[model samples]
Target: MLTEERYAAILKLLEEKKAVSVLELTELLNSSESTIRRDLTALHRMGKLTKVHGGATSINGVYQMTEDKTSVRHNLHVEEKNRIAQCAASLVHKNDFVFLDAGTTTERMIDYLHEQDAVYVTNGIVHARKLAEKGLEAYILSGKIKAVTEAIVGTEAVHSLQRYHFSIGFFGTNGMRAGDGFSTPDIEEARVKTEAIQRCNKRYVLADPSKYNQLYSVIFADLSQAAVITTALPDKQLRSHTTVIETDLGKEQTSS
Candidate 1:
């Protein structure tokens, strides 16, 4: 099939499923992985779709960015998240107070933290447990436990977060746009993120390439609000406005 034909088919699949994986596309188009990757790259450059780990998702649609446990469990681009987590972890120093947001991307930091004298605050129940197991001072905010994502979100959590300030706060979001800013689907989640941002001395947004240019329910912060963005290849337009650090796990940080 011609490249145009393959791309058209890919777009149609994206419309139907709202997302498609490279493996799936390879099987559907009877093409090689390299060819499928190239197709995704080209389509992503045109802003027609957002690329995810092994797949792509529709850009124009009513997409809900929810914290479903099953979805998070099946999250594909974990390597990128690990890379981001490592980069985010590097910013931590001894005795620093850090607030880690609740998300799979932020959760990856649990394996990389080596600081022993740090106070780690988070609304992620799983993350708090991990921090505890690692022998760090973990503060788990009180709030409504969201079973779907195992996260705490509500006024209680937001109120609790406002009481403490952090030396650095790391957050992750569902969708981000230049004008609309960083966003999440849940209002309570957005509230917690915004509170964390305001209470921290420095703010970092942890996102994979899949999240850039997407939109959600509420805006948490703008591009200027972030000290750095650690991700895979982020959208070029978004990169132009902020300090974009591109990394493959174990590679030197390339500033874009």
Candidate 2:
């Protein structure tokens, strides 16, 4: 097939499947893997598709500058979030000092947490309340609350985070891309997240597959800075950058 014909075929497949791997494209187009890879790279440079590890995903529909309300987000990817939360919760041990970022997935982590002896610190008001209800020791940072995501943010929150170093911290990101790393829309929240991660010995970003290959306004942490806890990694190359704990719901196994 001609290069243009191959490009058209690849685009049509992406429009239908939203993502496609080089192997799949090569077989479909009766072409070599090298040719498909070059086509994907060209398309990626042209902004026609997003080239991810082992595959290319359709360009994200929109750039989100504003965050969805907690109520709305709580309903999205519920199953994946729960699985990711379960894996994250299992990482906590007795007497560990943890920082739980305000997010739907992190909030779900509270439900699976069995470590009552671990002390928790959070900028999430709801998280703090939930932790308390579970009879876990919890502390909320002193700061201004952003109503949209219901997370505490401001210089006060950043300063409060600096005072104590946490054994582990779980964070949420609006976007996670290869080079840009983890990002959120709000600058104030990003500041708080940056400070919180800096004060932790180990950091984990709780995200679902949909969060991959997206970029937001403010970047809080680099891809290498934290291990990603997700049900599956869309991009295989991500493993070369940082640790990714893929959670299997059925077997409850994690692979890095």
Candidate 3:
């Protein structure tokens, strides 16, 4: 395997096992002992893992704040995102108006929503296109499109979102906790999310377990304001403020 591929493999293993010995990594990666050592050294230097005498351990299991492109994110947690999306979409009934926040998980919501008789307002450029292709009524928010996530943000989008109240507002966040509820990396996007949350009657944040307890660049709304639809329930600390609805994704059915 290539060096980058080996590195990613090792990291994925570490994520599952938390640590791995040299023999295990070498066999798992199908590489020589010397090669595994070299890869470990390189990863250690990059601060992605901690290289010990004969193996490595993960620094922390929390998701980092780095912003990945939307395309890359779609396949990262497909099953879990779909589960969250499915549950979120179920909340919509005929003639209900919904607000969709721009993120990979939120985008997955459109896949199941194709059959729902709901009117949609969204800030995701790609989401609007997908909704339209599915023959749903979708309104794309008006504003500047963010390069990384393709989310419509800035003053115009926030102001436009405030104009309409929604029956349900579904959002995906970079991170969430009790204090910094649903947050993102950009203040402009945060503003839009904050505005939408206020305009909606029932607000829900679609965050898989991977997003819980992690903090990001800005806080949009507190946990007290919204419900959480996720595969795993949050800890007692987070549950004190927000309502968490847990769903069994049957994720093992389709994870490649």
Ranking by lDDT: 2, 3, 1
**CA lDDT of every candidate:** 0.78, 0.85, 0.80
Cand. 1 TM to true fold: 0.84
Please, what are the lDDT tens digits per residue for candidate 1 over residues 90-193?
88999999999888878888889989988899999889999999998898999998876678989999899878989999998777676677887888778888
In candidate 2, which residue pairs get closer than 3 Å at backbone N, Cα or C atoms, i.e. clash? none
lDDT of 2 by residue, 1-256 (tens): 9999988998888776555777778788999989999999998889888775556777753356877799998987677789889999999998899999999999999999999789999999899999999999999999998999999999999989888999999999988877678889999999999999999999999987657777789999988899998876646545556778878533322334
Query: Candidate 3 lDDT, tens digit per residue, 79-183?
Result: 668878998887788888999899999888888785457899999998999999998988998999898998999999988987899988999888876666777
With a 3 Å backbone cut-off (N, CA, C), the pairs that clash in candidate 3 are none
Instruction: Note each model's CA RMSD in angstroms.
Output: 3.2, 6.8, 8.5
Query: Alpha carbon lDDT of residue 249, candidate 3?
Result: 38
Task: Give the winner by TM-score.
Answer: 1
* Two-way lDDT contest, 1 vs 3, winner: 3
- Scored by lDDT, the top model is 2
